[model samples]
Target chain A: MSKQKTEHRKMLNATQGLKNVMGRHFLAIEQAYRDGKPTAWATSGSPVELLYAMDIQPILPENSATISAAQKYSRDFIEIAEAEGFSYDLCSYFKTNVGAVISNADLTKGGTGKPTFMLSTDVICDTHVNWFEVQAERLKVPHYTLDIPHVVSNTNNRQYNYFKKYIAEQLYSFLDFIQEVTGNEYNEERAKQVTQNSWDLSMVWQDIYELRKAVPCPMSTRDTFGGLFPLFTMPGLKEPIKLYKRMYREAKTRVDNGIGALEKEEFRLMFEGIPFWYNLKFFGMLERWNSIIVYEPYTYAFSKYMNPKVTKEMVLSQPIEAMSELMLSFWYIYDLKTRIKKFEETVREWKIDGVLLHENLSCRPNSCGLYDLKRHLMDDYDIPCLVISSDMNDPRKMNETQVINQIESFIEILRKRKKK
Target chain B: MQKIGIFDSGVETPEEIVMAAGFTPYRFFGDPTLQPDRANEHIPPTHCIWTRNLLEQAIKGLDENIVGIIGTHGCDRTNREFDIWIECLNLDFMFFLNSPRKRDNLALNFFINDLKELILRLEEVFNIEITPGKLKDAIIITNKIRKLLKDISDYRKKLVLKGSEFHELVKNAQYQDKNQVLENLEKKSEELKSRAPFSEKNIKKILLTGSEIDDTEFIKYLESLGFHIVIDDLGVGTKYFWNLVDENLEPIEALAKYHLTKPINSIKYPSYERFNVLQKLIEDYKVDGVINIAQKFCEPVLYDHPYLNKKFKELEIPYLFIEATYNRESYNQLSTRFSAFAEII
Candidate 1:
């Protein structure tokens, strides 16, 4: 009898599982919408455990916009938003999300569904507040904003303490808002469980990323970028945990089997900022050149949970403070020094051969520091870095051939450096 | 003595403290002539042109005289500019004041704490003690300047002053010494009030809003096109001068309250406050149209545009939105649009 094909026989088995996880996640959201359950449009760094505990489905427009851009369907939605006076230079995710909402485009059929209310945090980017404001206006729903101040100094600074206090207060207020909107009592147990689940998933996700540091890194940027959907969409759920477990196992196996993401693995690269979601196939093209992007700071930044010691008991005891710390761990909340330290650590650990920084047109907070970061990485760490100008979703802002040429030239330089 | 530079939008800078700290408080305005090539090298091209221009000015405009620069967190672009300047500039001191967007007890507490931190840092950096008496004296001088500015703006609404002249007065106030600015405004106000109220039969009164409007040429162009900018909600215009710190309260807390209660801008939340302010301006000025002069790639202003458009439509107000840069070449299209808007109203 022929030997049965094992599930992990193919390199893409874990990635395929991630896709299924995302599919089911979206289907559940769609089912929730169909069932007349109130859903919310939440910022990626917003306190989502509250929504999950309240049984309110949280749909992240950023994630959905990424999906739309990946599917090459964001242009029409963006144009619609522009027609409504949204600037093309604004965050493309905003344009795509607002455009999709105004046009009544079934984003879930494509990626997400219309939100009944909007909840956003002011932690990651100023764009989140403005984007959700426009979305709430367009959808004619109530909008809630959680102001999470950036920690300007070390974790122990007075500013950080005040920020924690402010965020905790806001988180409690947010819970009250959720309760009022959903007409449901606050579920302390459920919220704790959700936070605990988030902590579990974060550990597994970090474990998977740590596995990529192995010689001949086991995962590709494309796989990790695609795998981020479940984490972004359903972080406090079993689906993402299961998906991450599978990913971790596959990466571990790849390390043990001495298999690299690329056939020859000539160069290991670190990609900064968001990729051009419209053309993820470009990542696959890099493999042909024997270069693999083993490190993407955005994935690691988003997947990192603040405290590993967080237990269900701790979460139940102080859900607001717990949620505040969780949201505060968002990479954008860090000051320049801490942020730079994190980047340097990632580069050292991943043994990054070169850095490709995307000067994303739509994202200011993420892209604004690329030039400064590139300068530091080059001058201080002696790491070669390149800044590629592109948009997160808008194809018009990118020249495909030029991007390819830049990447090829970068890869050639990396190869020459390695030879030296 | 070397001058301490401050961005025009540094409303919470406690300029008096800087003055007491033995440095001249020089408010840096955007030079329309400065090329943003150097800034573009540091910041992304998609950032606000106004901010890029400011960075260019910081890099080249104040070469030797600036001892330190105090930046504020008015918007994302401003925050990034502060980061770049702190990292790149070889200055004696550079500080960023992270002001909260909301106006609440917590926000005020944060603002006061930040202000106190700024004071302590200034004392440490410059080796100058900031006493309450010195702060009070500085507040008095700044308040006089603000009062004069308010007079000039109020005169503009009453048709006693031309829009270009009012902008020039405000621009001078931004750059000149507080005493010198007050003297000029006092003299200009007397001359303007003595003259006959200027009126044209068909000219439209337009209320300008959005980011900074420092282009004197653009103001002249609008006036030439038979439009009077009766009022504005710009960061560097009326919004900068209309609010004054309370003298009775502790100076630091008063400054915090002043910033928290300042006219709403696009960066702040519950943006209805901005709409309310704009509506009041429109009504007070009896404006014929509203002109939103936004810098391209300015997220805050761009985000507020759609809602403002809807609000204007609901209120039956004619609205003209124009995206601009700090270049003269870009004004032709703006001039044409303004002229068309003028005709329509």
Candidate 2:
């Protein structure tokens, strides 16, 4: 087991290096997409394209937020927002967006320019619609929310009608607002092309994840997380497709060669929480400890991971579900329990000995029911579990000593089990 | 319609809530120093001890009488908690207050209005009518108690009564009848220390905040660590008691006054006056550390933790965010952090 673990670590490290190179490529693509000021309007899959049509630099608030919690941000922003009266805990991303972007009038210093508008593609949580709506009211900043369909039964009609009646018309209004703000005409053809491109990449990323299911996984979660950068930083585009294909090919070669990504693969760990910010070197934990963490929650969020085998015609037929199903849309159907069950299955199939759940304080989605997950892991698999409480990004919010203490104790528990 | 139970610590519980619904307003005023050793075994030591105490009371059936609980995002720890806890323990709960940022007066005004909206929302959720008459009656009950405590405090200053008399008077004010407030102060136990009169034991005149150092060991730890620990304003210290009104003023106005008069210590104290009062205490008593002990997820402090850190940093005074959980296992580390800090005091 130890030798196999070493092999897994070696494989994950190499895969990580490849992903880092791929990340650089994705950044280059983002650089191309960058306009003046690097200012981004944080759109909640609710109605993001308005900013794109408006020429407002689009930055994923979830990206900054997760990274911020990983960085250990100015404490949990959701708490601050909740105290400010948005009391619903239905969506953490919404709470965070409001906390970090809207309420944090000082956020301008962090960015090159002011985030003029926040768009929401209200698909996952209904609370998000109210959240973005209320923020727009409070800040008096224009907020555009495109109601995406919630996939309760994999049916699109109810979702499509809901989109038309409550969301699509509002989306059109948002585009008009963008036109007024940026003076850029809405380019329908370009938008459709990017949408199609993103839809294709989604399928591709999903396929890559499926291939990674092989024992001594030819790819590492670290690689998948890193390589999915384009999807997050610049989703619905060409660069991500190119990047995923390259990584897929690289991993396929390793599998074909019958060489492990690591010379030895021992314990497999499944990671939760927005990846650690400063110590993004979180992957390094497995590297140093002779283990491999095979899957990450957020990386699978990309087009390819969630919507694999997506055909161009399939996406063209239902553009909204094509893009939204996995991102904004899927969360409702798969829900928290489904995701956890899937994570548990993945861990068992990967033959994981332990799980390192980062109980990120700020990420409501990740934090919700973590204690419950810890209980489940113990009762079901009798697997040793360690939960590190942390903020995803804001470095100021990280409690180094507390976290280090938890890690030491958790490791001790698992190690003690081995000695027995 | 079911009545919603609105409970808060210290004098922060509004006087008008009962009047709005015409139900008995149940208060949960606990002794700040009423040691809770049992809870220490269950929760982490770095979390809010006050909230831990509350949870202890709740889980232990001490607060089973209350129908529901309303919490605020005053700290990150408290903010993220409650829901998980209540579900696990099976208590009905909801979040009703907004975060208060007092940098701007308009923001503050907006904040008060937000609270007003929260009160109404609570009414709607609980299915009760908040009549003006009930508010006025509730105000009277709270005001009468506040005045009595003020009188006890004044008497203690003049040597007309001992400080223990006042502690006894204030500690049981929520449950005891108003006539008892004066009687409790008058019939205080004679546990006076002659070697060091009440003045000599001036309690190092410090403001102590930590996750439920309600355990005497934590208090004894602070004392053994060298600084005298005085007011527990933030945790299970002074803020755990609810005030009774005078049975006089308008209910809403009385509610406003109760929130206003609550001795403020950063966690949504009615006004900035609490900050001023805290500064005055630090200046007058030659106080040392503003140790903020927050339970993990005591939402109020998590929101206020950064600001308090900033203020203490700017003042160049000793302030520690002793974010311990229910039961802290790291005494060596805490001892090292505090002993070094105690040297400055």
Candidate 3:
């Protein structure tokens, strides 16, 4: 029995290390909050590098909501929010956070306390604009929004040039607002350093996701989902950099050793839209069927920051332009053509056998037109796609039996196709 | 000649550009009569009904006279469907006018540049020039229609027209050509002012706030229940005609300012602006209550629901929230809620 335990330990990879780091990070945040350190609630896609440069703690309610969902506590929080007139149709993440705040659920173990201020951007989705506004009002904190216009054309077009200028000016204004709230000067040098770190961190994440292209896929979908915490929470921090480095190293080793996440890998698949955070174990069940989700577009969406070649020198010299370009390049912020192009490239690169699209009921921007995208993929790329309707945070919206049945049937179809 | 259809949501594209390019500018306000079945093929079933209805219309080529369609960013639904529209519909010209959510200088400049880009694209597509003279003329026609509509709204506030009549008049104004709409509104304004005022005794004056509602049956039914909708903050009703483009400024700049600084809506940031607008509407219209007819999955309005409730509570104003679907099958539920709200007020 002791020898078996030792072998199991050897098989355990950086995912366990990642879990430990995340736990420690949350503990540190709780300690900071208890110490009355300055903290603010920030949107996941907001310009968080500025917060790092200013030495202000940034809390992401979405991240907390996701954690609560994974822990199966989102339903309680969601009910609380729904009781407060937040409809069940609203983003479950928003509902969960609002419910937790009103009910004092403390899903973050005191890590996410009352914020000093709130900040959000309109880059990824309008939900951020609405969600942060409601939170700021409820918490009685000053809220600031960065209105990053959508990129309507190609990057080289004149419209994009105007958009870049607009975003740069808004970034300066955002900096000014942050300075007023935090009583700190805009640290250009520190911001440049943070931006460089962000670029490096994003590159590592890109490599970590790209390494899954190996046959039998080095990492499982569940591990990748767990690995997203650092990227979402500590973008410019060294912790995520270290975490991803370890993950990449382990993934490479697994690839070399021909050790896939599943004992008998048969099918490689891609996931679309946000995962049902409450039922992420369902993804592990795929491993039972010898099927692995090698790619999820959500993880690769963060790779947008690594492109266009952002350097430390450019970050310092043209800080606003650099930041504006980074914000503008967010995958979800772009048009359908770009989204389709990226998905196609990922499908080709990962050699995806099938696709599982989540028709998340709560997210409009992410979930809308997914059926159309699926049809396009089927018709143009000859890729088989199946859509499952569920909410990422709200457990009530998901039927475990139904989801498992659909997934099983989908896998059966894929297997039959392979046999044919 | 095929017309260029302009979809709603405060589109900033100067309608004059299309007109000068020799294509008539037809505003598609979405047919409430259209079913959501066709649109569900392209968009999810849970999307905003107005978007779905419009997409259904586009899918069926309901108006074969339309050669192109222009979309604007007012909400998530509108913004996300732009690509789908181009791919799903057979149109030679398609463009989405990107607008910022704030009324700051930077946002205005971005809007102005965006309008300019739209003009350049229109020129390239239709092989026509959008001279300053043509733009000014377009602005003149649009402003005239706006002034007439404002007069009509003011008359409705004075109780010269009933809520149902006001809605019908606005609906007609939305679908007609600018010249015809202006001419009809001018004639109706004079006729309404000459009529006797509506009796205010024992009648509850309420304000309606929400997205575009093409089916006035529910609203008309509310009126039959003894509630008077004295003012509206709906996208299609008041928000569309409340502000006019400045005829004195540069055509593009005026259009940009008009689009940017218009009465606040749910999609805009800083809920305080929208709250302030509602507060002023409540006081100015002497509204006894507010009925927020929000769409079920509409995130922007749902997010603003709590804020609206808080403000109404502080103001000691009675308010009711009703979530509506495109099918309008839940009229009984709405009727019960409206009756209770009427009793409270």
Candidate that would win on TM-score: 3
Per-prediction DockQ: 0.54, 0.03, 0.69
lDDT string, candidate 2, B1-345, tens digits: 233343343334453464355544444443344445654433343444565566556556644455555554333233334444443355433433433322233333333454455566557656767776756655555555555455444333334443333444454554344345435544433222222334443233346653333344455555555545544454343454334543556445444444544456444322224556567656744555677665544444443454456577899978866655444354445787776666565
For every model in order, what is the number of clashing pairs? Answer: 3, 112, 0
The chain A TM-scores for the candidates, taken one by one, are 0.93, 0.69, 0.93
Q: Per-residue lDDT tens digits of candidate 1, residues B195-256?
A: 88875767688898886788778888788888888898775578768888899998989888
Rounded to one decimal, what is candidate 3's iRMSD? 2.0
DockQ: which is higher, 2 or 3? 3
TM-score order, best first, reads: 3, 1, 2
Report the CA-based lDDT of candidate 2 relative to the real structure. Answer: 0.51
Worst 10 residues of 2 chain A by lDDT: A105-114
Model 3 stretches astray by more than 4 angstroms: A1-12, A34-36, A107-111, A152-156, A306-317, B10-23, B199-201
Docking class for candidate 1: medium
What tier of docking accuracy does candidate 2 attain? Answer: incorrect
**Each candidate's interface RMSD, rounded to one decimal?**
2.3, 12.7, 2.0
Candidate 1 residues lying further than 4 Å off, grouped into runs, are A1-11, A34-36, A109-114, A151-156, A306-319, A326-329, A332-334, B8-12, B19-22, B61-65, B199-201
Candidate closer to the true structure by TM-score (higher is better), 1 or 3: 3
